[model samples]
Target: MGRNTRKRRTPPAAKAIAAAAALALGGGGLLWANFHASAHEPDQRAWGGNQTKAATAQVATVSCPDVGQRLTNVPDAARQGVARELAALDRQITEAYARLAATRDAQAKDPGFVRNAIVGPLGEKRAATIDRIRIVVQRAGGSFDNALEQLAPCATRSANQTNAGGGQQNGDGQQNGGQQNGGQQDNGGRQGGGIGGQAGNGPVAADFVDITKVAPNVQGKPRRTANASTGTFTTRCGVNANKNHNTDNVIVAPGVTNGAHHLHDYVGNQKVDAFANNQTLLQGGTSCRNGGDLSSYYWPVVRVQDGTRDFDQNADGGGKEGNVGRILTPVQAEIKYVGSPAAKVVAMPRFLRIITGDAKTTTNGLANANAHWSCTGFENKVQLTERYPICPQGSKVVRSFAFQSCWDGRNTDSANHRTHVAFADPASGVCPNGFKAIPQLTMRLVYAVPPPVIRNGQVMNAYAVDGFPEQLHKPATDHDDFISVTRNGLANQIANCLNRGQNCA
Candidate 1:
């Protein structure tokens, strides 16, 4: 009676309302709820702010999150204002060096003149000094390629102008405007007229190699962090519960394991027979799985010290400890006083580098992928115990800016260039012993990216990353290894991933 009494006669409006309610009930509230949730929740742009702010925030929020994100382009409203200013500064620095060098060379002929010129640009010869300055100025002018590329979407295009031919001019020091010079001078002791040498160029001619000069056109910029955990599996080495923990006993046996007793893969035939009992566990034997039983699974443990503390698992009863050994995040490792750079950048001082790393293969045919991901004896953790690869002689610092380049082994064209656009954590780290930790910093390099070029009807751009370690180019067998820090191993992974699909990110 209570329910049906009012339904004696449905008004036309009431009947329509009932029909709509029936339709909605048939579908349930899922569609409406979803729509409502989506509408209520902020849109991506609203949540993330904007693209430019988002990138800068990624780096700044993590370590130096509060830092400002200056547009890669020069902030000047005037035409080529930033470029002109950069070129001029470059010329000044270059002329300073050239004048000093020329005076030093002319000492025998005119010691008095040389001495006076050292203080200030002296007479007629000031032209060459000025020319050298011009070269630097030009290089500086063209070095805004990264900034320009970043600003392209917002840039107003003119019919007569093009983005091509903006790189540092060879020999002439005057970039883009078409002055002539021998070739761009690199800081590797090779003379050149440019505002600033590449950040990752090693310190000397002996360390130089034909490195790729352009940045790649993959991602706009690099993401600071990834989900990838930096640890790999290693079998227990010989016991060294003493002062000097040498890892000659630890060999790549035949099994892979996480911190737990679970085994994932085999370690292969590469055996480390240096210890008393030489045995390789294959296919997850009971002992290999349950290493808690030392008689079954005895992994030699070593204590690596970080700062004042030791990387001790403190496993009172040890076979293998979980991932509890205080691994340093990339942020922590690179945020300290690495060291002062021998050079400066953008009027600011930078720290020196200690160890550098890259993706190139060693004599062992072990690339970064194998070193970090393979089940064989090749691994970053193991290789570090064997040797500490630092900067070669003549390199201003052990580490340099990590550049971005093409994944194709040796194919670098204008379209694809490397970039040093990442200002994430100012610090970089290396595997000192069996684990990756931050090494003490010594110096830093300041590099500028050249503007892009137009060839065959396509416009191209270039950028730079750090840690070139050009010393690897030396013919000596010792020169063939990649630097072990600054995520060179990661670089190889990046190279490998890009080779697979250029989606390594």
Candidate 2:
């Protein structure tokens, strides 16, 4: 197959790096929208200026079809095996992307370098991995879809968005921060002055925007009917101040190490990792104030692009994978379970897993992009999906997630990880016909980050969610995950509290 062009149609923020990670991460479709920035003229501060245009404009990232989305069903027996193969695909993209980022110099000199070296070899790896997934399903007596093979080939995305005379810049006018004066400056933990940062990956200036400039984006809330479950159950989970962090994902890639390819700050259950199963999680200690709620809540840690390093700076899932800088611990982590406005709520089944946002939204379209990004003071005024909010000095950055509340009432998990649960209709507040409405878990995380500044094109002190190297650290890739391990008694208590319109903690 030949290269296919994908033009970004989203806002000015950078596009995605990998679609594969959404398997355990998040969901959305893939459509490259060509968002060309033709305004920024030549700037001497940038490298090589017009001399570097051709190579930079033609190639930006590796875009492959999301193979995991093709599987509508997989036998429960083969789900784990299939998940492993899918994760293999995700790893392939990451390795290829890291290489592409490292070879920027060579790519500039040879236009064919990325295609012939990175994308070509990556497709071969994906093909082999896809084949293994097919075998896993077939062995479990599940029908193998031929369409899976079509996802094997991924193309290099072009970057027509680069600023003119901005050799190392991001989109027009907006610059990427890394090493500034044609040399890499070791900014303690972050490399100053380039968009490619210390690891040659993201959180570019293109990813941030002044919060006040954004229009009001709060969606209309559903009307509360008389049948609405009006009560709430709040659980106090320490903000992972205990530093429970890992790169594993138990729900999607059980038993696989480094499954998330990014470090996650964990709260509630203390023993949730790639190898932990339902039994271990149930036995695990929790950080929640309510001992009855042993549920686990986790999300990728956000990092500030400063000149310092964390312990994992040189490790595979850390700086080596383009996730650098000091991790930001949320000052506030609030967890609440509320009743649906459409109907009285039921107890959530134990071991239910739910993901709230698409970590691959930059590559995955906005269909399932539910990241609620804003500042503490302006949260009700705006909600961002594609750009990181540049909060005012007094306001802190905020990341909020409202987990899906409608359940199929049978399976606690699904092959795609999303089909088992769904969000209530935003307008009507109703579950799909056969699905039951369960108590919805909502989380709000607040972080105090230095305001990043973009001057003459370069960005400073940028912050971003840690994600797959290929996902490029775009705010659009922000997301969260959860697993309910609440005891039956506590689960019933939540339901009763909500049904009675009482708030309990």
Candidate 3:
């Protein structure tokens, strides 16, 4: 797929790297490095500093590392060493940008503070970190520049400085920040009073935003209609009634602890976690209705909060919220495979994992395009807002996700957990020309939320998904991860059923 032309505000991988680096290196080390650098330089531009003209712009080309090939071919010992060094560099880069943001935030209180205390030092430290990372990559027999490129969140060249007014002009000549618009940093930096800053930027009430009513046609396309004629098979993964407080099992970003941020409702396999291997998952007990089927289906725990309460009040020891408190289990979980009736689905590669939904919704509006939210019994009434929906008295709130179903004939995963497989065409809903058709895995989670209460003529729902307390629970935040742990028998069952156009419930 062609990369999106717009620059991402903050890359998810970068944030994860920064967070993991912070946890590994004590905050004191980061503070000392920034402080020392800032004390020496008084005038150079900050990292990603504003620039006035495109003519004067200097383009920096960072090459993307062949991460997929590197991981597949490198010796275990060498890979481990590279990973450690990369983590250290990630910490330094994160701290540099953080210090830069702090200085920028202080501009209103103290004039010239950003230039004297932050700009030069931040740029120096960031450059040093990039250089160190390059050396590490070279030592591991990989391209140093490629490592830097991989760390960058966007495809565009990094802007050296912002315009005089603090707004940076993009290739199209649009100013991204400054006084005209709020002086929000475009690169995922803190936006004053924006959703990126805190979770409670909106009203505290547990009310549905009624996205269908508010922006009825915000989503240009009609909601995807179900194709009943398509062959399908389902795995009965029982509901996880008990609260799963396990913060370690998430496979989204390996090596990062509690990467999910919010609590997860686990089903299928009981032992799937960050460190789980195929062998471990195969041997692990399952929560599925069928004992032989051991696939893992997990997603963020949804909670019903009263209008006056917040979901993160009982956060875990790491100060990460949504791990504790009275968690609500889905009424049931529907895990199924759907595919073209004419095609045969080959057995899915073992331990294949897939993720859907945009984790960084605040800055990326297009990220939520694939996210689907609707009320049961009123399936056509789809809403794209991330908050809990106001279902009718007898209806249930639903969160549904459809995973890509076309495989490249080999490779279980790509660097981004996608790309190894691609989504079928929207019009035909069939695998593209070279890729083989696989059973499209879809998950539908039903939440029995309370009916809305009228508050000032607005219908308020009773709860929301347990997301970062600082971020308002929006539909853009809706994400799901799936890891296939099925042994050959179950995988074959899906293939056989789908090819025969048999519906296996």
**lDDT agreement of model 1 with the native:** 0.20
TM-score of each: 0.19, 0.83, 0.64
Which is better, 1 or 2, measured by TM-score? 2
The TM-score of candidate 3 is 0.64
lDDT of each: 0.20, 0.70, 0.48
Report the error of model 1 at residue 185, Å. Answer: 20
Worst 10 residues of 2 by lDDT: 47-56
What value of lDDT does candidate 2 attain over all alpha carbons?
Answer: 0.70
Q: Could you tell me which 10 consecutive residues in candidate 3 have the lowest summed lDDT?
A: 26-35
Best by TM-score: 2
Ranked by TM-score from best down, the candidates are 2, 3, 1
- Per-residue CA lDDT of model 2 for 225-309, tens digit only, reads 9999989989998999989999988877777888888899999999988988889888998998889889999999998776567
Cα lDDT tens digits for candidate 3, 1-505:
0222134233433533433333211111111011111233322122112211111111121111112222333333344444443344334333443343334225445544443454334333443444454555456666433333333221111223212112222322244332232321211122221111111222122224443353343233223335322568888877887554555434544554554545677888888765677788889888887777777888777654332333444343112331222356889778889865335578787777777664433223322335677787655545544344566667777888888778888766654355667777756556777888777888988888775454542223335555432233444456777788776488888877777678896
